[model samples]
Every structure is written in C-alpha cells, then in structure tokens.
Target: MAGVGTVRSIISDSLGRSVMAEQPPKIVILTAPGEGLPDGLEALSGEAELLVAENGAQLRAALPGAQVLCVTDFRTNAISEAWSAADSLQWIHATSAGVDALLTAEVRESSIPVTNARGIFDRCIAEYVLGQIIAFCKDFAENQRLQQRHEWHHRETEPVTGRTVLVVGAGSIGRQIAQICGAMGMAVDGIGRGARPGDNDFGAIYAQADLISVLSDYDFVVIAAPLTPDTEGLFGAAEFQAMASSARLINIGRGPIVRTADLVSALQDGEIDGAALDVFEQEPLPAQHPLWDLPNVAISAHMAGDFIGWKRALSEQFITNYRRWAAGDALNNLVDKTHGFVPSTTNR
Candidate 1:
C-alpha cells in the first residue's frame, strides 16, 4: 500500500546502491495503472529509481536513462524508441506469457537479454482450457441458449473421463493442461519437437511428425505451442481435415500458428465439431470477421490466461530474476535467440 512517491524513493535508493558499487542500472516500468509491483520489489524502494509511463510521450521521456524496461503492453512502438534512446539498456522483460508481440526484428537483432513470464500463467490457462473442454463436452452453451428461450431441455452428456486430449507443444502451460485433464480421467497425449523416453509428464508423448496421424483419435486438441519458423501455419486445411468430425480444437498459443482462412473454411464445412479460440491472427478480431458468427466457434478476446492476479504473478517473476541478476547469476527462463526457447536444454 505504499504511495507512488514511496515507490519512487525505493527505486532511487536501489539505483544509488548499484551506482556506488560501480554497477548502476536504472529501471523503468511500462504497465497500465492498477498493475501492482511484486512484494519483493518493495524492499528495493529507496534503492533503485523507478519511472512509470502510461503513454508514448511519457514512455519516451522515461527511457532516456533506463537500463531495464519491463513491458506489459506490446501495442506501442515505444519499445523500439526506448532501445534507441537508452544506450545503457541491456535487458527487456515482457509481463505476458508470450513474447511473440515484443519479438521485433530490431529487438531480436540487439544483444539485449530478453525474458518472458513463462511459468506464471500455466495453472490459470490450464484451468481455462479444462473449463472450455468440459463446457463443450457437456453442451453447456446449448443448454444456456435453451434456458434463455424458456425451453426446458434435458439430455445425457458425454463425460471427459476416458476421452483423449491431444496437446501440441508440451511446454509449462501445455503440461499443466495435461495434468489437469488427466486428473479428470482423460487420457492426455502431447506432441513436441523432440520426444524422448520418460521425458514428458503427460500420459503420452509424440514427436511433431505424429500429429497428422493421431489427429482423428482425440476428443480435444489444444494448441499451446510457441510461434516459431517451424510452427507458422502449422494448422491449416489439411490438418483440420485430418481431425475427427466430432473433435474440437482449442488454441491458447500464438495466433498465426493456426491459419484464419483455413479455420473459417473448416467451421463452415463442419469439418470439425467446434473450436474455442482465445487467440487470433488479428487481435480485437475485426467486427466483420466471420468467426464471430459461426455457430460452432467460440471466440474470446485473447483473455484465456489473463486473470486478476496476472500482473502480480508477472512482477514476481521479474523480481525473482532480478535477484539472480543482482547476485551475478545467470538469468532464468532465458530466450534462445535461435529457437525462441531451447526446449530440451532449458528447465520448464
């Protein structure tokens, strides 16, 4: 509950301590109002200089002397400006689970170390995926629609128990989904870049090549993979056609990973039963978009992993990494420039 001035003083003190020890590094926060900083950072109050920017002008002004910039929104081009304006800037931390939006060509080419909120949204997103799957399986949407019409309808519903779920990209979030799904008695299958014996925590594991062959067997398919060169346009007409006519797909990963046009065609043709998508190729999904009117498709405003405590979770991750950095230790969750993140080598 510290005031803004108190937070500013704490930041100044932290920076002063670093400067006196010949390692001064200014910190700038790029987040919307009401997003609380981590508890650990309260101790840094009076130790580092902190500046909060809400708009382009304020953001640019705050960047001139910053050494680290923490970004919460990727909508602005201010990131590039900040990099150009601050010669001392060496690290960039994204407060979201995915860093795709902030991975601009300029930022990627720079030597600055970049990290993301990798593990923060795992449980939250898993629960969301689970809810969607159960809702779809139980025909909750249809029941709700009937209720609004004042029609009494009762029907037997399918259980998730013993059903199969195929999860693409067994990362932290994907593994969490698998675990929760398994707890509900659903068989879980995961596909990733490399499939080693006894490597996955999910019920079953397969390599990327097995995706098309196994598409027809699952009751639910969840795409939680990162957007990389190999994953762009990975799910298109052919993959959709390969799925069972009764299967549904859920995407909580990068938007472009699933082709919009192909998905539209599949939904129109009834190629697949339904879809619950939280991400899209174009955000705010234009008003004219056909996906909104599709009967079997459920579209969300990219908020599946966004929850009340998300900001605090993100800030806590930064604080933990900051402590490591201050102690002269290697940063955790380092992005692999070659592959976004090294799957096999890094600990999830």
Candidate 2:
C-alpha cells in the first residue's frame, strides 16, 4: 500500500496550503467495482475515506465533503448528484480521454475544474492503429478465415510501405500515430483545428476546411481527434465520397465522428476499401446492427487502448500531476472548459 500512501501524501502536499486553511477535502471514487480504481489510490482507503459508490444515492452520501471525485464508466446521474451535493469539490479527473459521457448538464454547469487522461494512451492506441493497419494490409484476417474453412487460397498481399495516411487530429494521439506511420515509410498528413507550418512529422498539416479537398489523396485516414462541437459528424457522406476507392478509414477517437449510416452506405457501395472502428456512435453497438455483418468492416468494442497496465499508468500520471499540484506548479493537460484544449495557439 506504499503506492497508495505515496499518492495520498502527494495529494496532501499539493493541497497543503488549502488544508492548512482548515479545508482538507476527501477523495471519492464514483465508479463501479468492475471498472477498477486507479492503482496506488487504494492506499488512501485508510488515510482518507475512500468511497466507491456506483449509484446516485451512494454518490450523494459520499459527496458531502469530497474534494476530488474519480469517475470511470459509471452513469452521469451519480456525477451530477455528487457535484451538486459537494459544494467544496475542487477537481474531478476522468479515467478516460473523452469526458463527453460524464458531461451531465449539472456537472458541465458547475465551475469545478475537470481533467482527463489525455496523453497517457497516445502511444498504446497509436500502436493498436498501426497493428490493425498492418493486419488488414497483409490480409491476416482473410487468411485466417480461409484456413478455418480448410481452403487454401493464394492472394496478393498489399504493402503499407508507400501508402499515404491522413491523420485527422494533430493532438498527442494523432501525433503518435503520425510518427508511427512515418516510421513505417508511409506518407503522413495531418488535419486539425489549425494549420501549423513546418510540422516535419507530417508531410502536411491542414485546417478543417482542407479535410475534404485532401481526403482523396490518402490511402488511409485515421481519426484521433477529441469529440467537440466542431468535430461531431466531421466525417460524413461527402467526406467518405472524397476518399480514394482503395482507401480505408480507421476511427479510434470518438464515435459519431463518422455517421454510422453513411459509413455503412459507403462500405456497401465499395466507395472505400474497408474500415476498422473501435468506437461506435452507440455503445455496445446494439446486437442487431447491420455493421456487424459487414465483411470489410472490423468492429471492436471500443477497446483499442485498454492494455493490462492501464490502471497503473493512470495512477502514475495522477501521482505526477498531484506532485506538481502540491508544489504549486502549473498542471499539465488542463482542460479549457470553453474551447476544450485552449487551442494550442502555436501551431505545430
């Protein structure tokens, strides 16, 4: 439990000034037991009252004096109640990058500072994307299916060596994907909210306006951007139509980025070669959804970045940030409630 103790100590040290003012706050975990608390935080169970409340009532009961609330895949109703019941709440940290699920009307309306595990999964997810691309290009899935049927079929395997990849986000995750693709000898282009000059990692970086114009140029398009107002439905019919006939798309960012119906149409029409989607516009992807039957589409249960050590990594990140907070240093990856990320003014 030394890890937990260390986390508590770091948090205490970070809040030393506030604690000295007779305002020490409790930390609450408002996620299901199945979701698992971040490692190192369990040590705080003794030093600090650790409450794992999965429902609104339990959350409300535990929120009276809580300062920091860590939430995973639990519902937003509990989050709303916790925020409403705890007037002393100072910060909230989501275990996932996309906070949209936790953005209940009440929580969003509150002034509490919220942060997410933004950069932690960048490398892991980029690797997953790369692996999927390689698997699809090498026809691994097709080969396995053919083998299972006891049929030996020889087919030409495509190489991703000279393919062009259009990364639709220049953030940490997108940048990581671009770097990996570049290392594989693939030409990489990036699109983000702003266009920065001389971003060597990418062959070119363009603003949102240029997405359509350049969509047809890339052999593969990967979406790793945040789910924001501007990015909702960013890839629709027109965007898919603009892609090359042999192009494929991969979305590891947020669901709803590509309209599912339009994507189905594109796949059915052979407008694009294939797609690999880890996230869906709807969770659990509904059992009867037609997407499940698409031969060219691979559907994952939104689990690209979930590695075995995710909890430990999340704990380490929290600990580092807690130490910085204790030292009165500026926090890393602070979320700008208004514009999401404060729009990295200096374009990359």
Candidate 3:
C-alpha cells in the first residue's frame, strides 16, 4: 500500500541518476453528480494528473491509468461497480468518516489500501455531542417553544454536571466526547468492540454485549458507533425500553443504527425522554415525517461534523496524505478493510 502512489516506473538519466518515468501518476477525484469539486484540490495539480469523475461511466473511464482515487462523494457505489476498470488503482481515500457505502465486497477483499477522513470529524462531532447534551439537560428546546408562544413560564431544568454518560463506540470520536463531557463534570463510560477498564478517556469501557444491561444507568446515551453490520438497527424497541424514562439519546452516528419507527414509539410511550438525531435512515427525511413534528425529538440533517469551510479542510487533509503516499510513507487513517473503520488503536 505504501508504494501504490510512488512512481512505479523509473529510468536512468544522462548523469546516471534515477529519475521517474515520463508517465505521470493519474489521480481520479470521484464526486457526486452535479456536485462541485472539493476546494483546495488544485494543490495536487503539479504532483499528479487529476481527473474528476461524477458517475460510473466517468469513473471507469478515469480509472485505467489512475493510481489514486479520492472519493469526495463517499456515499456513492459507482466505484464498486466500476472497480474492474481500476487497472492501475493502488489506493482509495474517502473524504467522509464513514466508509460503509464504499466498502463493497470487492473493495474490502482487495489489497488496495483504503483510507478515511476519521480525525477530521472527531472533534467537530464531539463538540456537537456536547452541545446537544447541554441543550437536552437545560431543556433549551422547551424554552424556545415557550418563547415562540409568547408565554412566560418558569421551570426547572436538569443539570449536566454529575450526570452519567454512556458513549457507544469508544473510538477517537467517542474518546473526544468523553473528554469534553468529563470536563463538564459528567461521568463518562463507553462501549466498544471489547470491554476494558481504566481507559484514559472513559471510566469503564464495556463491550457491545453489555449495552442493554447498562442502558438504564446513564442519564445520557450517545450513539457514536460506526454503521457496521453489527451496529445497523442495533437499538430498537427493547433497547429503548431498557433506557430510563428520564434519559435522553443523542445519535450522531448513522441513521439505521436505530429503528426509526421503534424510536418514535419509544418517545411517544415515554420509553426515553428525548433524542437529538443528526443522521437519519433517509436523507432529507420526508417533509411529513413524524420525527419532525415530535416535540421531544430534535433533528438536523447530517451536518454535525460539517462546519464552514469543511470541504476545504477535507481537501487539505487529502493533499497532506497524498504527499505521504508519494514518499512511500504509511498513509494516515488507513481503514481496516474488514472492519469498515480505522481501528481506534491503529490510527491514534
């Protein structure tokens, strides 16, 4: 994987020095149809021949001599469908943190190295989780509603300090969330692929198997896990029922992680107090979706990790990694193809 982006062909110059062959490495930037290219991509213009592909046909055409593929449109499967045409493809990079959509069977089993924008989102998402927690604990939503109605009603709100927080997926993002929540005087524990104790960030790290057993104990439960096969639809009616009625949920993870219908039922039945959801099973959740009208649920498009100029940030990250690739250095944020994420231990 290290040499994938290195100039493969070499020749001797007049001075008897080794020089790269005349054929320059071609890099393909895969974007969604009609979407503008990522900012700062011009940084690579002098290093490699850059081509943009917005669909399968374009990707297939661009992959023949392409050594590197930068997938700005992480959600599309065009790459999987056009993989056979990747005759010279050595490395693939996804600008988005989640690579579930890109990890097709062929891509996962192949030796071609896969990387993701993992660290880029961790802190931004951590801040989002913290903001949502504060909003929920302080009942800011209710205050907004009361203000909208032009009524003055004084009420007591819950305090975040000293409350328990259970963060599922104790990876980099989860650890950052723990760091911030802990700073706010909250007791932070985590659930990950396996259980461990005395972790630097979490008080106790429990395995996924223990999630239900520990559900009722925490005042706040955050779904920060990746959307692997094991996590899709992980939280359903029973899981919701296991939660304390006073507890709130924050889902900045993939939408399918929680069953929408079951979640709605739980909220209506007081199975859980409230939820702050950024991602949903459906993008641009239907205008008539009940989740939108639910008083206890706060919803947003999947923008928790997207701040202003984030596209430029993502492009800059790729440029930094591209330099590493050219130098035969181990790329950062290398995804464990089998696991669909950069293992927490490996990337950090």
Candidate 4:
C-alpha cells in the first residue's frame, strides 16, 4: 500500500454541523488502498485534518492524534492494538454493516461512541436473499449442471408463492427481506428478541422461544440477526432437526451465529434439502472444506450486501453523520455495543 500524506486547510464544508468549535478536529480513516470513498471528503479537510492508514502499524501511529476514526476495514483488530494510543478519539465509525470483529473488550468498554453503516446494506442484502430463495425453489443449481453436461433433462421446479419463510431477525435488513418475500406471496414469519405484532413486512412475529416449534413449518430459514451473546450458536443440531427436510437455509449474519459442523452434518443427513451460505464460521472458507463438495449447497464470497458503488455509499453515510457529529447533533445508526448491533428501537 502507498503512504498517504495529509494536507490541512481551514475551509469547512457548509453541510457540516452548524455548531462551531475553537479548533478543527483530527479525523483518521483506516482503509485499504485502491478503494473509492466519496470524492467530496476533501471539502471537509478544512474543518478537520484527515489521515489515512491502510494497515495496523499505520493505524496505531495515527490513532494517537485523532478524535474520530473511520474504520473501513472492520476485519482488522487494529483498534485493539491502538486503543491505548487513542487518547483523543471520541467517536468510531465502521464502514461495514457488521461490527462483530470490532467488538473487543477494549472497544466495548470504551466511552467513545461507535456507529455503523446499517441501512445502506439493507436493500442489497434483501435482494440477495430473495434471489437465493428463488434459486433454491427453482433448482437453478441442477439447471446449471445440466447445461454443463448438455443433457436435455427435464425437472419440475417448485413455486415460491405459497411457500413459507422464517426471518430470524427483525432488524432493518430482515424487515426489508420480509417485505419483499411477503409481497411475492410467501408467508413471512419473523422471530425477534421481543416479538410483537408485525407490520406489512412481517406476516407474523414469533418470540425466540417459539422458533423451534415453528421451524418445521417454513420452507426457507434466513439468518440476518447480529452476533450477540444470546443469538450466538442460535442454530445447531436441534434447530436443524426441527426444520422440515425440504427447507433451505440462508445465512448472511455473522459466521459464528451458526455452528459450521452442525450445518454440514444436517445437510449430509438430509435433514435439510439445501443451503445458500454467504457467511461461515471461517471466512474464505478453507479450500479443502467439505461444504464446497455438497451438491445441495450454494456458496458466495460474503457479498450479499455489496452492490455497485457500495463503498462510496458507506463513505457518504459517514460523511453525513460526520457533519452531524461536528455540529454536536445526534448521530445516525449509533450502535449499542452490548448487543453487537444497532438497537432495534433506534432503527424504528
């Protein structure tokens, strides 16, 4: 990665918070090289000093001088390495939607507020989930195989209109998914920590305690919940056993939310008909992994929520909140560190 030098100016963007402070704040951006953030960030260079760090060493060095940290690489544990050095950091913003990797004890206990790019990825992930549902119901995997073999084989595909779906999370992303699935005529059921009457998106809501009993009733099970103490290992052998044999599982949440071995075993035993896994316990899912060989599984490289220009969207969102933060107004998409996600109350 190339080193980026900072250029300071005194001009602040008019869009920034209306409030004025005595001095320009120092902001550090932790990002990989060659990625595009919004172009207009330079306009704020006058209001705040901007520093870019692409790796842990640089991040640690930059942390000592910054009041705000923009973490473009959520997977990096550099925050922990530089926590002691972040004497001036008052706020931390993560570009990625999930903050599981950033929820270390040090960050959790820090007085600094943490926020994430949440709603930006909601629609992208919802569309991906819908696509997976259709693919599984239509048996697109077999269709592709037949195409490769040049075999004129004919098979009956299932209709998704009357099928049922269990959305295991009621956050913005899950609600968006439920809305889409419901509109398409699939019965949408949601499970949340505190289940209540659903809106147009969710056809019905179920408490976590009712999950196992209803597992066998749905044809698709989707995991979109954040990784929290209560939701970790939420799906295991028992849950898999409770699912109908024809049900397909789609996981887009944190990898640790679902147990890998149990999922693979369920597939092997024909406990579930298929799976479309966009996340796993281990990312880049080792090349030798057995899931790759499964005929009934669809695998993606953790890109369900990534669309064209998504990075820029994340950056722009940060900039909007940056303006609000600089003005001392309420920030958007603030996270409740204890739950490892933006609290549902905030989203509503």
In candidate 1, how many clashes are counted? Answer: 16
| lDDT per residue (tens digit) for residues 298-348 in model 3 | 998899999888999999999999989888889999999877888876422
Q: Each model's TM-score?
A: 0.85, 0.87, 0.94, 0.89
> Which segments of candidate 4 are over 4 A away from where they belong?
1-22, 32-40, 346-348
Q: For residues 108-218, write the lDDT of model 1, one tens digit per residue.
A: 888988887887788889999999999998989898789999999878999889989999988888889988998999999899886645644676678898889889999
Any runs in candidate 2 off by more than 4 Å, and if so which? 1-24, 33-36, 74-77, 104-110, 342-348
Best by lDDT: 3
- CA RMSD of each candidate after superposition: 5.7, 5.6, 3.3, 6.4
List the lowest-lDDT window of 10 residues for candidate 4: 1-10
Clashes of each: 16, 1, 0, 0
Task: Please give, for residues 13-86, the per-residue lDDT of candidate 2 as tens digits.
Answer: 56455332232337777776465565777654544556677778887888876767777762355676555688
Candidate 1 residue 327 C-alpha distance from true site, Å: 2.3
**Model 3 error, position 342 (Å):** 0.9
Candidate 4 lDDT by residue in tens digits, 215-306: 99999999999887888899999999999999999998878889999999999999999899998888889999999999999999999998
Better of 1 and 3 by TM-score: 3
- Of 3 and 4, the candidate ranking higher by lDDT: 3
